[model samples]
Target: MMILRLALAAVISAYAAAQPASTSSSLVTYIFGDSLTEVGNNNYLQYSLARADFPYYGIDFSGGKTTGRFTNGRTIGDIISTKLGIPSPPPYLSLSQNDDAYLSGINYASGGAGILNETGIYFIQRLTFDDQINCFKKTKEVIRAKIGDRAASKHVNDAMYFIGLGSNDYVNNFLQPFMADGQQYTHDEFVELLSSTLHNQLTTIYKLGARKGLR
Candidate 1:
């Protein structure tokens, strides 16, 4: 019986030793989209229309400080991070000081951002999808430099890429103008545009080595 117990202890030790060290480090999560994902960039935009800084915005979040997340509490990205075993990404604008921590994936989502280039109805600081993509590319480069090619590749390929958009394109471009100028595109035209834009964005991310993308 003693010999059997010793063998069991040996087996347990071997199994524990085989487990990888806990690195606290994890793959980077890149959240890209509109107000839904905008954690704080709007505060620097010099525009009040797209800002979400006030009571009741982050009422359900930790400390109840308005982090500029549009939702009443944690945004979808935050929920995804909790599921993926990593910290919620920081906003891109807040990374101006070259903090390597922010480079571990940043939120390029602007509050009034849209899929179309000319869709920011009344806001001058709104970002278009093209602009968001450009910022994403820049963030990728920074991640590559700081985390090395392999880690960066793993970070991107394995990381969760959350994209929440299209609603703004509909709100700011289609519905608003339809109400104002009575300008109407058939429903088909609107759907086609949205689909094509989404496809292009996903294709771009796939090319960037994104294997685990979400919408």
Candidate 2:
């Protein structure tokens, strides 16, 4: 999968690469990825060990309050949103009961997640890339309910998408001796699998109404 930083450079010309439509106040962003793009998704995963809730994790953020970002400050996602002049979207789980944040978009990234479903199994409760996409789909349904179908469709089609994945598939799965992928496939085969899966994943988002592909 394409890292969020790489996606940033490719999708936008400058101003931190999350360029909102010139006619709109702010472009809604649908974020998907691993820790590098995760804001606070993992913190709400009850069984998740991939959380970044510790104080040191947000020592550099506003008021020094940890918001589940893995970094000591804002993440690539946060920076992108700031550049676009909007609040960073909140975690997907955090939206289950909140409707006021829909216009801000939703973040489905999870720490330790990867393109492959099994990539972060050791994290015990991380959302794989597939899981994140599913959450986005559910998010779309909620958006439709909030607004009429036509407006919701337009909203989704006009939104920006950011995806960052794959690092964990290399660091947490393919490189781990005990992982099934490492035991069953050669390096070349593993890469092919990743590419193939990601292609389908991207297609799904497009079919669901996203005009741009981030990964």
Candidate 3:
């Protein structure tokens, strides 16, 4: 875990440094991933074991208080948002359909979430990639209600999306000996499954008005 954190940190720093400066303001940014990018969505899950709402998780963040970020400091998504001069989008659970916060963006990442619904079953509860998309669908409805269809469509299309999924599907699912998926699939088969599922998910996002994003 420590090694992964260091490697990701280095990558974030490198990416931040490589980007040219821009005067354009940030658009709404949708974030997706596992614990690596989760802000506080898991905190809202009552029976979830993948929670990180206790001490030391957000020790290095503002006010030295836990914020359910799953790490002692800001996540990669947070770091990138900071570098981009944008407010890190809040957890999806922290907002409401009637809230004005949707205009900024939302983070639907969960601590044990993955591309597949069964990927983190051991964690008791975690949003899958499909679940996150459903949350976005609600967000779309809210935005559309607020600004009407045409403006909301433009808002969604213009927003930037960042996806950082897949890790949990391996570490918490297929790689676990007790899990059925490992026995059911050869590695090649598993890869194909993931690829196909990801393709469908991306297609859904496109149809939902996602014109640009990173995965």
Q: Pick the candidate with the highest TM-score.
A: 2
lDDT of all predictions: 0.71, 0.83, 0.86
lDDT of candidate 3 vs native?
0.86
Better of 1 and 3 by lDDT: 3
Question: Across residues 33-80, which tens digit of lDDT does each residue of candidate 3 receive?
Answer: 889999999999999999998888888998789998988999888987
Ranking by TM-score: 2, 3, 1
Error of 2 at 1 (Å): 6.8
Residue 174 C-alpha lDDT in model 2:
95
Question: Sort by lDDT, best first: what order?
Answer: 3, 2, 1
Runs of candidate 3 exceeding 4 Å displacement: 1-26
Clash totals for all candidate models: 0, 0, 0
Compose the digit string of candidate 1's lDDT tens values, residues 80-157: 565455677888877854587654677878888877766765777866677878777777788788779888777777
Candidate 2 deviant stretches above 4 angstroms: 1-4, 10-24
Residues 1-215, candidate 2: write the lDDT tens digits: 44546756445436444444673356678888899889888888898989999868999998898888999998888887777676788888887544768766888999999889998898899989999989888888888888879988998998988887788999999999999999999999999999999999999988889995455
**Model 2 lDDT, residue 144, Cα:** 87
Sequence-dependent TM-score of model 1: 0.78
Displacement of the residue 166 alpha carbon in candidate 1, Å: 1.0
When summed lDDT is taken over every stretch of 10 residues in candidate 1, the lowest stretch is: 1-10
For candidate 2, give the lDDT of residue 33.
89
